[model samples]
Target: MTNDIIPVILWCVPRSVSTATERAFMGKEGCRCWHEPLGDPFYFSSKRQSLRYSEEECKASGNWDKDIVDVMQTLLDPEANNVGTDKKGPVKYVFVKDMAQYIIPRQTLEKIHKGQGSQCYRTDGETCGTSRCTGVDSEGEIIENPTVIPTALMRRFKHTFLVRTPTKAVPSYYKCCQDKMAGFEFFDGAEAGFEELRILYKWISNPRSTFNTDKEDGPGAVSFPGKAQKQPLPPPLIDASVLLANPASTIKHICDQTGIPFDPAMLSWDAKPQAEFAKWGAYHQGAENSTGFKCEDDGAAKTNGEEAKIAKLPQEVRNTIERNMEPYEWLVKRQTTFA
Candidate 1:
């Protein structure tokens, strides 16, 4: 919220090279990026008792409702040193990379069931005036709504959705599951990343967004949370293929779309993970192994891009790929293309 620092949120699905994107932002001088601030909370609030991570590990991750609230507050804290400078002076943005799935609608239901009520849905005074999290879906259907995260909180930042073809991202995500010792049975074909991305995009597109205001609770009052009153432009959509195809152009394009100055440093970074990411590096090895985007190849080395290899994949995995394609294509078509 500072005059000098713009808060940016990069929301992507698992194995989208999102960590590398975060590293790109981290490369910018004076910019500090968080790996996944909402991860622990999301894990703690999850109802999946038979998860791969131990219950103790999940508990150790922390409570979702409390953690998200804390992060929202911190990101908006005026006194914090969220702004840093390069040769151009003050830093223009603070980036946070998070998986779209980290925020859960099911967790909201779990909270309500526990009598925690809707307090978990509140954001800063400017972004959220009410506790109700209702919105119209892409289909124009209106119904009772429980946000995956507070809508008010989401409106506070410049958001970008990083997407990859499911034929690639799904199998890679499965590999991560295996690496973590989570059995293959955990993979769900129905939990496509685009489904949640669309939900977030639609909510963000709505003009009736809650935001900070002087009146905490009043019958009727106008509030301002973001840059202006009208619905802001749709968040920037960057395809992973586009990013890898030409990292410099893609990163600059993203900076332009988000209103932040492009920093050449964003094109590359040290291969090592940041100290804050030490606890989560095991899951981020792809990013850790890469110093920058791969241009010599199509960025498919990690992914089995061959038709033969894809055909050899388990039938269930192929089914998941088939199911995810519709949404993935829906998003990819909207992405900003570089030449």
Candidate 2:
């Protein structure tokens, strides 16, 4: 509404509360949800022309090219895709949210601010657009719709990036594969650096995801919040053992980073519905099995309290999340308050 043209780009790893975030915005009136630019019911549709995509496509689009974002947006343009153009609801905001962007590269993202023409296209093969590109599966069989034109579709609207915890990220990515939504070979031959992802995840969820946008650590690299803070490197960012050893300090640390006001929502006694397209299905029971915030001041390795059920996940889960959330860390921190 501010004429500022804030093309909000909502970003998240699969099953990382993306839909929940989208729903929250939708509820605010002025927003229209676009599901994941590439997810569900339609991506796997047996029909050739359902005009749908799943997060998996975005994941496998080769490199996490910044142009991929622009191209994807271009493909979603109502002028190109013909569906999103006439959309209307309480919110006129355009959400270019999808879990797949996490697997892409920094240069590709840097290109996002530049505009189209930077995108790499399917030059030799038939492209996906305007009755031109061929709509084929990985094996080359034509599907119902034509090729998916990332460049042509997404160029029509504004963009933003929403991000979250890395611990939740890998779990969700794995779950997407388990549910037949994606493939185990998705990351095959790709630049999947787990240690790097762990750092990126924590950084992005700090509400400053974009502060260091268009930047990357060369190698053997680590980024701390400030120049003065000095702590030896280890499993946990700020001396995990030391911080975890003190719960109160841990909570304060979390507060310092995320800027998300601690809330009673973390201590809810209500049951939570099964997460849609969630990788943490093992933790799911049903909507009736809702749980509430159980934040406590217990002295433990996870310094954060009961409100940190999410902030303080098991180490193994946290490790998995760090490994997978290499991409899109900026958005992760930018919207740290939603949960």
Candidate 3:
């Protein structure tokens, strides 16, 4: 039944205006959107990799014990309730907005490269029975260079990316962390999220990759029992600035690419706080309050005191952004342009 549903994931960096992008999709008929579903498992699950939050903080936040595989299953579930909705029904399309960092934390990836097996968790939070459980194939052989979420599971979605310039994104993220109401003592620079996005993008775009080994019939040509399937078109990349500069055309372009019908009504919605976003504290306040897409006075102008702000950022934040700029620009060059 789930196979009949179209699943789309918008992998994004923090402060990339992705939540608002999710809101636009919420206005689309028959589309159900999930806001950062993988984050719960990544930050709070039993097999969690981050220690940034203490035990008390973890307990205060609900969904502190979700498994990665279980969350992935939920995303693929057609009848799963839409964000902020209790009623269940069939959905033709499922849209997920999530950070790439949540899918595979940099530290976890490093551990895998060092030959330390990260335990694979079942839906029940129990570890799988495999001896070295980075990821196991259908036949239970260990997958090399495993992502925190298995590659096989990741291949199921039509992936896309939402990127923001490090100059703007880095400062915005730091400001969020500095907000007392946002519930963080200090920012974790590792969560800047560009490196992981690049890695996933490359893996998805590579034709010779093992992720395309499925012999099932689909959009790509059919493969024999042991043959590789044809490579999929590379995922679309959307820059936050470009999306904001012209929301209607940009979103239409996105719809055209993803096989969704373009509707002008997707440009606006009732402004209110969403129950799905409440659990994250103030991180989503901007999205929660937005009535529609609006470019800031200097947003498209590109002269918005951005340089001044970047200069004031802490040295660590500056360094993180500097390290991420290469990948960020690489993605920017390939972003889908509507203008």
Candidate 4:
């Protein structure tokens, strides 16, 4: 919570090798790494936005009561215990890796603005703002829609992004869905997440204009409680391909930008299952099994197999990739590059 404690978040697209990126920072001195803390509220909360799981499945997953504010408070608390690891002390940096879509899904934002009420459907089939709900504030006032985290809370952290080519990311994500998420065979195009990342990037660049504007002037604009300082420089963006091709230089460049000292040890670590990633099942298997950054297609068979998988993608999946390319390229052009 002190001004000296640096909080950094790596907002990423799914299957962008983001978990591996988090792994690079795991054992660094004075660092605390959190694996998708916001994911609990986004996917399992009573007011959850995702329909990927059934009501029973969501409740069975864990307690779905915590909201965005609770999650942020925990991350920013200097005395809080670490989620997955026992490393604890005076923290110098708090690093989080999470999918941007989990923070604020594009469709959920659209639905809320269209005056359809909260998209939070409870397990009992009740909407969030109804009489039986807990959507009111402590003073018994209707709580405003939490479509996005408040601008003030967002500014607490130094934000960065991790992106992958849609052609590659889309197919990779589809495979994860098939392999990990039971009964979810087809990819949910909404979860491709480029649009949410674009919105967040623009918001972070100029939050005052994006969040403080009149409802008629900006899409999904809301009155936030605090002023958002205009960022003097754009936050760093890391392309997954670039990081894989040059792990040391790319990670060092990121460290320089984010105020962390570059360490050679970040490039390699022992292959061990991370306790934090266990909650998400096998979604992070590659990262858990990796000792260091390596080309995903290290073998000829892998190269050919990945190509064949991409070629056989369903039409909807292909369309999702096409839709995301514009945003993906926009992010790529702005990514931090190393010689």
Candidate 5:
């Protein structure tokens, strides 16, 4: 069925004000919002099992992948939910906030192999898997097949990336987990980092390239599928620091990019947190406490001090921050700037 609602997919790292941004979108007229529907699969994946999350948590949250798929189908179906009647205005947006790392890499690879809008490196009819990356093959020649994003998902939304400097984000994230999870060990760059964000951005910008091909190849020049039509621009990148500096303006800028009207309701919300957050409130206390985009002077000062404390972090943490700098800088350059 035809519908005007735009699907807004927000990709963010932890502690990047992603929850707050989701709340802002919730306040907007004709908007339906969702938290990390993708979090469970990512947390349960083999790569992340020993990191910030635990298997016990995964067992408690069964079938997370199915949950996300159902939610996505609902959001995409114009006739599935009566979205327009919930607010005075006709529903025109579905705002979903998720982490870049939350996308299951293995699943994405599988879909690409099935030709779910993904291209790949092939020689003699042997399509390469995730291991086939950009670099010298045994023949000593450069193989440059880029890992395209899964088009089945990419075509579903106008994506936006929310980023923060590693110095500010990493410490804040570690502290959050420490407060919530008992005996949580300090994670290095491999566990808590911006590499996933960078990887996702590359795929989004070059969705026509090979999926799971290689992260290093980046978005090599590729033609959009439809002949002669202009390709859509890559998702907008919003810096948390920039958004916090001027929340209203930054949100408006983002809305414009996503083809949605800027609603004043997005600037504020109820003093109490919404019922929707109950399922994950433990991990989202900061957003729950905020009533609006306006940052208090004292709060701002405290945050600045906390950010400054990054220098005093342990050596391993410092090293992780350094490792994250490359990708963080890449996204920062592409972020939406406010005057």
Candidate 6:
């Protein structure tokens, strides 16, 4: 049952054009698209209460855990849904674009896959007699993975990750929450102030990370002093800003690590339809009346004298974006070095 499912893992910070990028891949040839919104895609909604199987369903017959295992198998393989969606070409590659939230904390995910994938993490209160959450122990205090779905079953799936810039991500996120590009109420008070949001910007901009690990995000993120720590904090998941800033260098970075050819189209939507502008309305509620970066769509427009607002941001946050971007600036300067 192993189909052509190519797990196109979208490792991205929120507001990093993930939805747009996914739309591009789905529009490609022979790729099946499934949205792991929050986590579960296809059947279960987020309001999903939990395991609803009776004792017989759990033990004697096909158990909840076993059932999920089968479903994961189907998802990893090819599906009719992915075939010929692209009128321009024949379908062969099946793409599954989702966030790394599926594998929060990393170690837990690795443990699950160690054993055919466990359904313990996917338990609902009814089945496991507990809340619909998987407790994760990190830094000491235990917290729910927040986004852990049917993990044991889908643990082994692999996917490609897309990363982007932090500074741009901040404004974009603000726009989304305000409803310019497609945001949710959860974003309410998302950017109460520029300084506060700047710290958040650095958190999501870790570049090396892309999934929400039990709300494991959000701490006052100030810039690294560049003062090499006694041991240098582990680099972020993947320096997304690094990629967006230097396409040529990004090309080599991807090849050096994954051996995949860099398709220029990966950076920008080539077939972006004019009507797609309206699609923003579907995801964002407040976008109907925003100016430039305030809206989810067409945020590329520069603001009139927004520089006056820079000082409004906390010095720590302002410094993070600037200092972090310096490496990219350096790379651009050495253009002759990039492939």
Best lDDT goes to which candidate? 3
Candidate 6 C-alpha lDDT tens digits along 1-339: 333233334444455445554554444444455544323321132222222223443344223243322334455444444433444543444445444433232233223223322232342222322322234244322233222333222223333345444455544454454553442322321111222112222333232323223122233212211111111111122333444456445544533342234454444443433232342345522222221121222233443334445446445435544543543333223222224
Q: After superposition, how far is residue 77 of candidate 3 from its true place, in Å?
A: 1.5
lDDT of 4 at 64: 73
The alpha-carbon lDDT assigned to residue 299 of candidate 6 equals 30
Query: Which residue pairs come into collision in candidate 1?
Result: 84-91, 125-212, 126-211, 126-212, 127-210, 127-211, 127-212, 128-211
Per residue, candidate 4 scores C-alpha lDDT tens digits across 125-175 of 322343212333455432332335654566556788889989888988888
Pairs that collide in candidate 5 are 119-210, 148-210
lDDT values, one for every candidate: 0.60, 0.33, 0.70, 0.69, 0.61, 0.36
Pull out the clashing pairs in model 3: none
List the candidate 2 regions with Cα displacement exceeding 4 Å. 1-6, 38-91, 100-159, 179-339
TM-score of 6: 0.44
Task: Give the higher-TM-score candidate: 4 or 5.
Answer: 4
Model 6 alpha-carbon miss at residue 333, Å: 21
Off by over 4 Å in 6: 1-5, 19-74, 80-84, 87-90, 100-147, 150-152, 159-167, 180-186, 189-236, 248-261, 264-271, 274-339
Which model is ahead, 3 or 6, in terms of lDDT?
3
When 3 and 4 are scored with lDDT, the better candidate is 3
Q: RMSD of each candidate? A: 7.7, 15.7, 7.5, 8.3, 8.9, 14.4
- Residue 336 lDDT in model 3? 69
lDDT of 1 by residue, 1-339 (tens): 444467788888877878888888876765767677766555554443123356676666565235555555465454443433232444456678886655645433232223212222322233322333344445663222235444444555677788888877888876665566322335544344556665555455434433222113232212322332222256678888778878888888788877668988778777775665666646677677788987535446644455667788778678778766877887777676554
Each prediction's TM-score against the native? 0.73, 0.35, 0.80, 0.77, 0.71, 0.44
* Candidate 4: stretches off by over 4 Å: 1-3, 81-84, 105-147, 181-186, 207-232, 296-308
lDDT of 5 by residue, 98-128 (tens): 8766563533333222322212111123343
Clash count in backbone of candidate 1: 8
TM-score of 3: 0.80
Q: For candidate 2, lDDT tens digit of each residue in 228-258?
A: 1111111122221222234344433332332
